[model samples]
Target chain A: MEFLRTLPNNLLIYIIIAHTLFGIGLYDMMFRKTLIGMLISLELMLQGVGINIMSFGTFLNPEPLTARVITLFLVGICAAEAALFLGIAVAVFRNYQTVAFDKLTELRG
Target chain B: MSFETMVVNIYVLSFGILLIQVITGGLIAVLSKSLVHCFIGLVIALIGVAGIYYYLGSPLVAAMQIMIYIGAVCVAIAFGLSLTRKAGEEGLKSPGPRAAIPPTVTLVMLLATLKGLSDRGWINVPHKINEAPVGHMLLREYLLPFEVISILLTIAVIGAVSVALIRGRT
Candidate 1:
């Protein structure tokens, strides 16, 4: 019970959680059939990466400001990416009427 | 139990709950058929990430995580979902045997790497906390990049609007 209570302080536990998020995101990215679903997976992957960087910065680094700044930038980038991707998804849906992966195979040779 | 120990236990319990929130939310986002549910799950997962950031000692980043992810991104996604018809579909065609391979491989690789990483020792350095506030650093050392990001955001929003509007006249 004491050991369980201390799990939050350990670097390994943070790494494991970040990795689990990454793995889940990767699986979903591959398996999801819609572009928006892929976008959701991509966000998860980015969140995992952010957590990994922040944990490493918190524990291993002498200074943590750089990590925070990087994270801030990551958030900004995520917002931009989400806007662009969703806009594209909307545009694609307007054209094709469906955004399903199997249905939109017009480029297939 | 000692007073300090009880406090520590409470903190740990909260952390555990946040961890569960993140994992469950991610699972919900991925597994649900409805886009609305997926966005809801994403919002929950992102909130958990923000909490984790706060636990890591940066309230600034944590706050930004909430503002950008929950406030901005999720709303944008919801708008997109609303514009598109049949947002509840889970891809039309039946996923064959090949569809199962990638997630299986991901799970296998995750387990293998977890085994390798769990036993490894990482030397923790005494944290040298930041002397300057984040806003000061952003305006000083990170000014150029900060300006670039703002510009990029402006251009992205404009471009998004243009792209979405382009074929509408056709």
Candidate 2:
């Protein structure tokens, strides 16, 4: 019971959770057929990485700025990546009429 | 139980709830056949992650996660989906059994390796933790990276618009 109360305060628990999230994202990234679904998986993975970094920063680091700054930049980069990727998705859909990964085979070599 | 004990228990309970939210939301996002359902799961997961950030002592990052992920990115994805998908699209195709093996193996390997690493004792080096405001560091030390990221965002927005427009035209 005491251990249960202290679980949240532990660094290892957060690491495990972060890893689980990343694993889920990896699974979906490999399994999802559509481009948007892959994008969603990518977001999940990014979230996991963010959590991992933040936890390490909170628990281990003496300088807090590094983690917060990195997280902020990560958020910005992801936003930009999403915009560009969705635009590419839209273009691909326009050209191919479907967002399925297997269907876009024109450039296959 | 003592008052302190009660408070601690509640904290742990809420933490558990947030963990459940994140895991369930991730599962739903990945397992759901419908893209819209996936988006909903993504939102729930993002909210839970925000809660986690708060618990980790970075409320600013939590707010940023909510605003950027749930607010901007989600809306953009929704727009992209609506624009690309047909009116009555029901679900996406699920990968075959053979295709699932790679991800499963990768996940297992990753977790195993990480667990091994965690077993090694990590030192939490005792020092004076700098509690400087985020904005202070952003403008002073991280100014270059901040400016570069802003530029990158601007370029991305413009590039997205141009790419979509060109594709639509052609």
Q: Pick the candidate with the highest TM-score.
A: 2
True contacts kept of each: 0.60, 0.66
Which candidate number maximizes DockQ? Answer: 2
| Model 2 alpha-carbon miss at residue B7, Å | 2.0
**Chain B TM-score in each of the candidates:** 0.79, 0.82
Question: Candidate 1 lDDT, tens digit per residue, B78-99?
Answer: 8887787564556323446766
Q: Which stretches of candidate 2 lie over 4 Å from their true place?
A: B87-132, B168-170
True contacts kept of 1: 0.60
Task: List, residue by residue over A33-78, the lDDT tens digit for candidate 2.
Answer: 7888889989999999999888877776767668889999999999
Q: Can you write out model 2's per-residue Cα lDDT over B74-132, one digit (the tens) per residue?
A: 99999987887754343545566766664676568657757766665544521234445
Query: What TM-score does each of the candidates earn?
Result: 0.88, 0.89
Show pairs that collide, candidate 2.
none
After superposition, which runs of candidate 1 have C-alpha atoms over 4 Å from their true positions?
A: B91-132, B168-170
